[model samples]
Target: MVNRVEVFAAIRRDARVEGMSIRALAEKHGVHRRTVRQALEGAEPPPRKTPVRMSPRLAPFKSAIDEMLTCDLDAPRKQRHTARRVHVRLIEEHAATNLSYSTVRDYVRVRRAQIDLAAGRRNEVMVPQEHAPAAEAEVDFGEVYVILAGVKTKCRMFTFRLSYSGKAIHRVYATEGQEAFLEGHIDAFNEIGGIPTRHIRYDNLTSAVSKVVVARGHDPARDRVENSRWLLFRSHYGFDAFYCQPGIAGAHEKGGVEGEVGRFRRTHLVPMPVVDSLDELNEKIREWDLADERRRINDRIRTVADDFAQERQLLAPVPVEGFEPGLILTPRVDRSSLITVRMARYSVPARFIHRRVRVSLRASEVVVFDPDKSGRTQIARHPRVVTKGGQCVDLDHYLEVLKGKPGALPGSTALAQARASGVFTAAHEAFWANARRRLGDADGTRELIDVLLLHRHLPAAAVEAGLTAAISVGATSADVVALEARLHLAKTDAIAVVEHAGAVGGAGSGRHLVAQRHLDEQQDVARDVVAEARRRKVVSLTERLLLDPAAVIAGLPPDTRPLPSVEKYDQLLRLRTGTDNHPAPPTEQARPARPALSVEETP
Candidate 1:
């Protein structure tokens, strides 16, 4: 076949040459006579005609439509008049006579070409080389369905793409909360190796805008404006945000990211990815994303990885403190002497347990601080365990307090039950007993003592108040005795008070007041001591049985047992030794029983 460019060139040449017969040239060129005649005539081609009008009904409003197109060609397509709108405007505003709606519509259709030609604006070409590298980035989120731990879950996939480099990053998250949004940026920034100089473009995602800024201030006029409050996050992260006009127009600004999201889902997150855990799946996806850095782009000589390396040099360095995306709340200690943080329990030293403390929360940890202290001591730290209503101090911290305060052990049924369950050790019991000795038996004192016990886990300063309170309440040996008597169905307030005061104050206060107020308490303890000693004096068979029944029955053994008559045993031993001061000879020592052995076993 002859080339079309060559054929067109021949036709032009033949026309330029003077007078060869046009018909002969046509036959020689294997062209039609009419085509040769037209080429020779050098006539301007008649303008291409439009197809015949489908509807004559739109003819009357042709002039109005033409005027609208010419005046507001650049206006949004939605704002331009449709056939129905033109019909309405003609009847209402123009007050035109005898203009039916169908006639206006048909007229507009017939004049469509003329109207469009009049409306057309000149187009400008944007040279690609004029744009600099890292000028802008497009960001968006896509939805990805992933099987995590055998459960299908939907995740928001964050995508970011550099306009010039076409380098991109895709990340998946369970939610698009603020933390996740910020995290996605951090990841994308790292993947790109730097941030784009131009502001990021995005659709009006809720993460970016709380409310669309339709207007501002009182008696406001409606206009598109940046939502200032929502812009703070972008400012904090050191990025300018260019929000697209709400919906589809904005979507075009981030078209690169849209394509990247789809590509990532298909390449890295698709075909029903299954894994033992979500973490593992994410790890695999991250590896794939990193690997994409090495893949060469279609038109670019450098790989995405190489472009990202350059971008890294251009990006702002992350602060040494790094980004903290979780909400931080400051809560005072409740009257229960506990601070609630993230629905988990933690103990402050007894003193600050009832006072206000500051709570610092991060995504993973919650720290309670004693702001009153000069150094801002961390009174408690706990894993964040968000609950439905509110957080509780850790029960384990409270348990440690119980373990520290032996006296408080009696007040906590839970502690006592736990001890009874054989979970507590003998050493723990011993320690608790020692604490009870130091603190009095009063409920407040006991509670304080328990608080003091928390010092074992926290700081001693925390429980100082509990210790002082316990001591201030006449929690002496005498008070303990009074409490014991009361436990055994003895009620004597006067005696109890006197005994406690005396015990706490010591003999410096004299015994007279104590005797009058706590005579019964003192007498009871004395009686108990005497009774115990008397019981020890009256030895039962059970106590004596292990002492050797045969020896006791016959008479105490002279050598192997304690002598029933000490003087008699001493005299005999002395007589045998023939020296009152000398010890018995080694041969006189008692022999143990001999072992029986078989002949082969006997060496």
Candidate 2:
């Protein structure tokens, strides 16, 4: 409660003005003769010297603890010992029963610092820095936690901050992989409308640096063997990369972004965002970035946006053509019709099994492309799984395979996912149940699979509507489902066609009469009692069942012919001009002579 400096002043004043003896001053001020002598010598008291007290209990274990601490210098920084660990070890190993933990902790703290100092390690020395407009920027990834879909998930926050303006762009990703890294840069560049003219500072992230060539007396610039993809990306964007020295030495190289990451996290991401998906989290981050532009960092006179405005014009314009940030991969599909990408599995079409397919692994999605003479065509796309061993499967991808092994359909992971995602709707469940009950499981599931295959061509809504129509009519056949789905599609097409005809008819030209006649025909069909309810502007079919189900069902005649077989038509695909199997019809002149001779012989 008392100030030591004030006490010393009082003692010195009393000694001088009262002319008190050392004993008298000691009695009056509650001070010792040594303290009185110190006060008399100078107004400011000399610091008290710490006593070299002996620790009798701790003496026996000192060597062991010292050896442990000394050896920790060679161990990993994360694995090094703390005061509590040393105390525990002493209690467990040395059996120093009477020793207090505080005693060991105090000694360990002082001794560790001394040991580090002795080993030529000291606190880092930091100096002030100045940044020029549009000159430099820093890139870094910081860990962030979010409650995604009611589950606690760890995510990475990519921050790109301009040194001069303190203006930053932030995006959250599922992983800190090269795809996310490159995408973060692309997003920052596009958002800022330009790139930093000078080199950008970066830590030696594995995404950019494949190998760090650490050699004595070598330039840090050439020390890194940049990743080929990263080099190509940087070259496309027209920017230079300045890699920091590895480890602690490089931490301070990008201090601006390092501090920015923490500042943004503490200020905006404090509550640990609750989001349904990563895109939702990033949407929040984008809003925060915009709000931060109006803020002032530390004690600056101008806001971040104000400073950025002046710096914006100085920055180099973004390149006209942008670069693809997704990492390209080629993975062979297994028997399960799944391809493994970055330890995660995603389903492609069953036709691609045992075949290598090109994948563009982006931050949020994986795109599979099938390359042919016609060039690459995207066959499947799924959300990228964040965790290792995770899978993203589409039930439609394995329809053909499931058709052969209908027993596997009920227990398949893809089917489970489809049910979870509402892709397999109640109508589908109802239809499958009916089919299984009527046709038995094996044949019934095959029918369901056939109906499922229609989803590849028809809209899911149409297929779901078709299922409902079939269930209402007590139709267990996949053909009925296909026919209803096709009818639903026809209705949609008719509506579009009618609208287009109406627009064309407004031209009031003679040629418009054709469209008008088609429109009139469609109207006449709608007015007909048989098709009246089928041609209305309807809501989503998945949300509503068809009107007049009994009437439509009764109007449907029993189909004896197999459902629209195209198997025979496939032969026409291999059209041969002149082959023994199917020679083209002989010309009349060419066949006439042979025909005349054959007829005379027959007569």
Candidate 3:
């Protein structure tokens, strides 16, 4: 193997303004040909190792710590004790050490038994026995790269693994926001078929934690807890929650889910899982988690799924319907009577503009439930915007209000921009007409109305400029029209040419053209006849045929009556025949004719 130093040295020696063969350099330096070539190609040499020394202050405790760690090779990792804890113990009890904590920790870590504990592995192991009733589940978030909707979207998967059964539930979401966090819990509980007995465990995530206590001389107990607020919400669904210390490294009580979260990400979400959509991807993740629950453990009698099944009965029953998780906020409507929720704007009636509205937001949608308690009416609904740190407002809602106020049009920047951009079609003119009717003489209404035109162009920007110019010069609509004509004349020239060529001869050049002109003149008469026939056909087929069959039958007595003698039948059939043979015996002749009724003559 060629060392980096040798390869780099060879390239430098050969580079002295005179090139040398990389292969020859490799032979001379005793480095691999590829290494020499890479060096010559401007690759940096590998970094040199720097020697680090143990902190001398803690040298004395190193050996003792190492021995203790090795002695407890089979003990649980939490029981083995870290060097920092050991050093603290030494100072507190033995009163013995000039030793620094770092030196002792490094020595013990290196010399400790390499025994692989099941708990230490990233993979989760099944609990050896059935969990006690009411044991809480620990929840956490893990990040994994997944392909969603054809883009490599970074998604955070929420993991909730039971402390007793080792059963893990997972869901992937676009964010780790509060909605995702709370919704994940609800879904996981539903999958487990019950809520945990007493409380659910969680790290000091912002969703649950309001404060972190770091008092000296005392173990941190996540205090200032807002359990009431959470419980107020959760109480509706039924679940108790407990939080772990903010930054503790203890694993005896809280490490189960930490390892499980990592295991799920690596085993199920890594190396690129492709899905058609986020929902599909989440469904795949859920299936994988459920499948994981079915695997048997080496030391456990039942699988994770089986253990969870046993614990299900002990869990609290969920509410009749689950509580929807969301962030609640209040926002005031703007002068436009529009409230901006989740970046997309929605509007109340103009009467309510500037009034405060309550918004109930969810993961996928923003529901503007009726603010007044009169009834269960929804003011508006908009798709939830998930893009971080931005506001999304639906401009269409305000457009509806603007439709009622035509006078507000001129000042509407949106409408002005639209007009300049050529977005105003004939439909926009009709909308403008309607708006003007609704909002006569109201300047504010006009301004709002102009906003509708912001995205349209009818009068091109140049035309608008010309109109504005005319208006500035105190020109009326007639004056503006005259100015437009003058501008059009000034920018364009009329062309004239004399045509002496006689008409050409073709299939339709002479007679066909005259005939076409005649046909066009008679089009109205032809159209009325065709329309009447179509109307009659529709009535006969759909309504009259159904409502009064006898009336239709009376109108067409010949069609409904039994066939007359062969002579009459042949005459009617002749109308359908195309100058060929008489219409063949009605295919019904294949069956015997009904027996002639016995003569009841005179009776």
The best candidate in terms of lDDT: 2
Per-residue lDDT of candidate 1, residues 1-603 (tens digit): 876456646777866784567777787789888766665555443344699655453455567777765555667867876778777777787776567777776666756556566555333243343235677888888888877657776767777888766777766665665556766787777655556677787777766666565654632222234545346556665677777766564455566778788877887765878875444666787788778888876777999878766666666654444454544466666545566654555455555655677776543356677676753577777544433343434333454455456455455644554455443434334434544454434434454344433545443332332233223333332233223333322223334544565565455335477554465566567556545533532122322444688756676435776557667787888988888997644453575556999999898
Q: Compute the lDDT of residue 386 as modeled in candidate 3.
A: 57
lDDT tens digits by residue: candidate 2, 239-277: 999988778877888888999999999998888989888
Clashing pairs in 2: none
The lDDT values for all models are: 0.59, 0.86, 0.62
**Model 2 weakest lDDT span, ten residues long:** 536-545
Q: Between prediction 1 and prediction 3, which has the larger TM-score?
A: 3
Q: lDDT of model 1 at residue 159?
A: 78
TM-score of each: 0.44, 0.67, 0.45
Against the true structure, candidate 3 reaches a TM-score of: 0.45
lDDT of 1: 0.59
Deviation in Å, model 1, residue 164 alpha carbon: 3.5
Write the residue-wise lDDT of candidate 3 on 1-603 in tens digits: 666665586577776455777677777777788777667766577556799874666655555665566557567656877767777876876565575666656666665534334336334453544447547788888888877657787878888888778888888776787777777887887888777877777777777776777678877765645644466667776777777755554344567788887777778766899885567877787779878988864587888878877777788887777676767667888886667765566555455577766677765456765567642466766555556543434333456555566444457654554554455444445433433444344543443344333333333443444334433433323234334433433232211000111112123455578765554445544445444433531112224555788887787646566765677667777777755476467577686787666678434
